[model samples]
Target chain A: MTKYLAVVSSKAEITALEEFAEQKLAKDDAIVLLSHPYAYGEQARLPGSVLKTSFDYLNREELVEIEGERFRLVPNWYKFDKEFEKSILYKGIQLGELPFGEVDVFFRENLRFLRGLSNAIRKENPDVVLTGKNSVAGSSVRAVAEKQQVKIIRYFELGKQRTFPLFPNLTTRKVSESKKKLSRILSELGRAKRGSKKTVFIASRGYLGNLEQELREKTGFNVFPLELFLLRQSINPLVAVKPFLNKKKLQGLFADAFNKYKQSTGFRENMVFDGVFIGDLFEFKLQQFALLNFPEFVSLVDRIDALFQKKKPCLLVVWSDFVPFEKICVLTAKKYRVPSIAIQHGIFPAPIYKKAGFIRAFAPLTADKTAVWGRAFKKILVDNGVEPGRIVVTGSPKLDSIYNRHFEPEKFKQQLGIGNKKLVVCATQPASSTNNPYQMVEQVLNVVERFPECFLVVKPHPVERTEKYEQLVQRANCNALVLQKTDLHALLNAASAVIIHSSTVGFEAILLERPVIILVRNQKRSGHTGKPRLF
Target chain B: MSSCLASVLQGKKLNELKKEMRKFSLERNICGDGKATERVIKFIENTAKKTGKIELKTK
Candidate 1:
């Protein structure tokens, strides 16, 4: 009998695996569904199958030392060096750590998943490894399988009815900017209505929460959303659309950027980080990214330069400095000698390892000052080597709405048709951070099943898909609501007890004076709460 | 379900569970008197004035 090890990351992948098995599996074949144990518990409904989870194989932690600084292997933080940062310059100014922000953070969170996956591949030694293509899990699985010399089959979902061996390469397809054009027009309209000589450029209006209105009414300065503001001030629609119109010109521009990067950094010849040949990693990431996205960067640089030339804002504010576009804005503002502030949008954890080079999203302040939620968050930043003077405890402007607005829980519960049952709110973390999101939902559903008095409402992270939660709830035949777009404060207010796996919602739930249960895989991973308090 | 969660939902008083949860201090004052938005505005006003960008409106 051939043994098969199937790896799944998202809930959608579960369905893909089911399809793969239906077409590929024989009756005598043995299968083991390897997942994050808590990620998808009973949802792996293949009968008579052995199951393994990411938690089962998280034994070893790998580190790559570069120039006496130890960095984690998963995020590939060796690329986050000063030399690499200096290479991607626009008009001789560094383009603000472009290649290593959002994606790196996700990798950092999935360190456990990667490590566990590598370990599982070694031990399971399955005859064939099946995985989805074009996912983090898929990429890691491919790397691990190649190293272990295991036969790997990548399953690709084509149309509604067809499963294919591989998906068509659509990278060379023409770029669509229709949505962006509409947004730019809308932004122009908004700016025309509220344009002023004395304007303070804020990040996205979405990040401003209720403060956007308050800033306009209370403060004398006109609040302008940064991208819209910049687009209106600079970037002619014709100029912006020109690069997309000429395919060859766009490719030529990308080639120029790539050649410049290689010449300046010597990355093509000897891009070694502390003895490891890391050139391929850069070739795949930084060089490839700069090549593919040169036009957008060029446009951004032009727009920013024009914004500074035509109209310089008194101050710039962003939700996070580490994010690519916001980082560019912050860096350019600094170059123009304009002050910028990055507000702390999410709660941060204390340093997990005592190592010197644990790359955190908040480290090495890019903005002149960082507006934090509280002293605790500020302390975390300071501990991470940020200057104390640059840290301000402004509290959370987003949380202000929860405190100020009156929420009637009883009426809201009635509206949801959950009549008088003890409401249990489970706010899930993203798949990267949590042990198993599927398992977490399953655990909550099990509790709701046991206690007839309790009703569950699963609130998935903004990044996560709610269909998985709905699927699990349906499978378990439980009375639970998987709400992705409901008012979080109302849900918390209506909840009799709040369950979380290290989310900012836990802090919110605590503030609302609700009973909270923090589900941690172990004590070591409980950096968000300092210590887990399970009551 | 784990016993801790099972116990939380298993006939325990909601007030008592809340009391226990509060015992584990989150170390920092999360939100202070719900005036965070006002403080953010005040910070912006101060920063803008210090930088000589825009004039603040006095209430």
Candidate 2:
């Protein structure tokens, strides 16, 4: 049997990825030696036949005496606050102290831990050691494996291949500008050594809105929304596309697509009502646009020249899925010796079409270090050839609030004003180039209508066309609730079952233990079943 | 100056290098190794004694 060591910093990431990996490894004879930063004395029983190290280490008395086949206690090393402790008590996982200290001290401690783990590996000598890329645990595993000459496999769940390049380039530009600004400021500082003021700027995209204030307080840097850069660049879609495309092909295709799309304004106008149809096309077009607009190439060289004018170094932090930008960032970072960190924006699952020639050929290289939402994404990075040492599985701070959430079905039903009915959450996917979402939704609705005692909660994909769905639901005249701004987790907790067509929310619903039915009709040739379907 | 392991490791020396050539290789961040630390310290002490040097002493 293949023995594997999986380490995750957060419970949620561990929970999601453990289940996913277990399912994949079930067919093969394997035992997973699981380690987490938090104690897993409660909420254990992950998928597949696996041994949890933390669980084994725990004394019998420490195990939560929970009754049920599904319940098991696994040890983890996370220290929780009072409120979190209460929640952990409810869930059954014991909380442990998180090792926190000065960065150098933390790293030395981490290295010491690795030495022991390496010895453990030597004793057990597992065929493979699996971990997230760049995570502390993951890095520790890699370091140990390197010392011991063991095979290490890394995986990343959120494989946004294209976005990796764009960040480096953007950071290079930012660093160049910062260097110029810093030189002038430093020169002024030199002239007036006393009473000179210095300011550091920190900027992030709206995606990192949750961290804006925290980052500001920690670093005493001016925090600005990443949209500021978009606005600064005028959201030049072309600026994003040019790095990947052949110049002539990009220009010709862009002109043709733009003109064709413009002439078909009537069809395009209807897209607001049919988001699926237009969203997929729009995504493809944007990808094309990125290829054509190679302006960043010339600009990057000019920026490199400017960097030579100033002597100070700058740090660039990027988090996004725009691939060309990431490539540029990587190249510039390497060229200028600037430190660059890429934060994983969301759970990035690999494109399902692993066998596709184009996708395989065009896959972009990842960042120096990637911050992942969970172990699921970290695993995805490892699977894609990223070294485990470069991945950080920081639990999605955004979903940290959701980790402790528990909902009562009765109370949820009362709030939604649906009485004594099984709730079905229907999340729609936008139409892709090869799939028609309207037909899929209509088909699923047909199945849903058969169950009169069921209420369907429709959460449309952001880019989905809603008018048709609204009309279809009205025509069926069933107990249907259409929500635009309601929290998905709340709705998911309230649901008895979920129906989706290729949206990622389906997987989230499954993680929440809701039965999900995937509507498969008119899907793209890309081998991805979109989101996993649960029956 | 490269050891056999260094030659096989590619890139730079494992201790000096921060990045990996490939993204999917395994890396770890281990903690809570009092036992292993002691073992390593012992090993170094023995090696230092054998070599007639006091390099293993803690600062």
Index of the highest-lDDT prediction = 1
Residues B11-58 of candidate 2: C-alpha lDDT, one tens digit per residue: 234332222211211222211121222222232223223432112121
lDDT of 1 by residue, A162-258 (tens): 2321111111221123345437547544644344546787874355466766776676776666656544433355554554565356557556655
Candidate number achieving the greatest DockQ relative to the actual structure: 1
Choose the strongest candidate by TM-score.
Answer: 1
Give the alpha carbon lDDT tens digit for every residue of A53-133 in model 2: 432333222221111100110111111123333322211112111111111123223322443355556666777666555
lDDT (tens digit, per residue) of candidate 1 on B1-59: 45665666555676765665555434465655678888888988898887874322211
Mark the regions of model 1 whose C-alpha exceeds 4 Å error after superposition: A7-28, A35-45, A60-87, A92-96, A109-114, A128-197, A204-208, A227-243, A246-294, A353-360, A431-434, A524-535, B2-6, B9-13, B20-26, B53-59
- Number of residue pairs clashing in candidate 2, backbone atoms closer than 3 angstroms, sequence gap of 3 or more or interchain: 89
Query: What is the DockQ for all candidates, taken in turn?
Result: 0.33, 0.01
Interface RMSD of 1: 6.8
Q: Interface-residue RMSD per candidate?
A: 6.8, 21.3
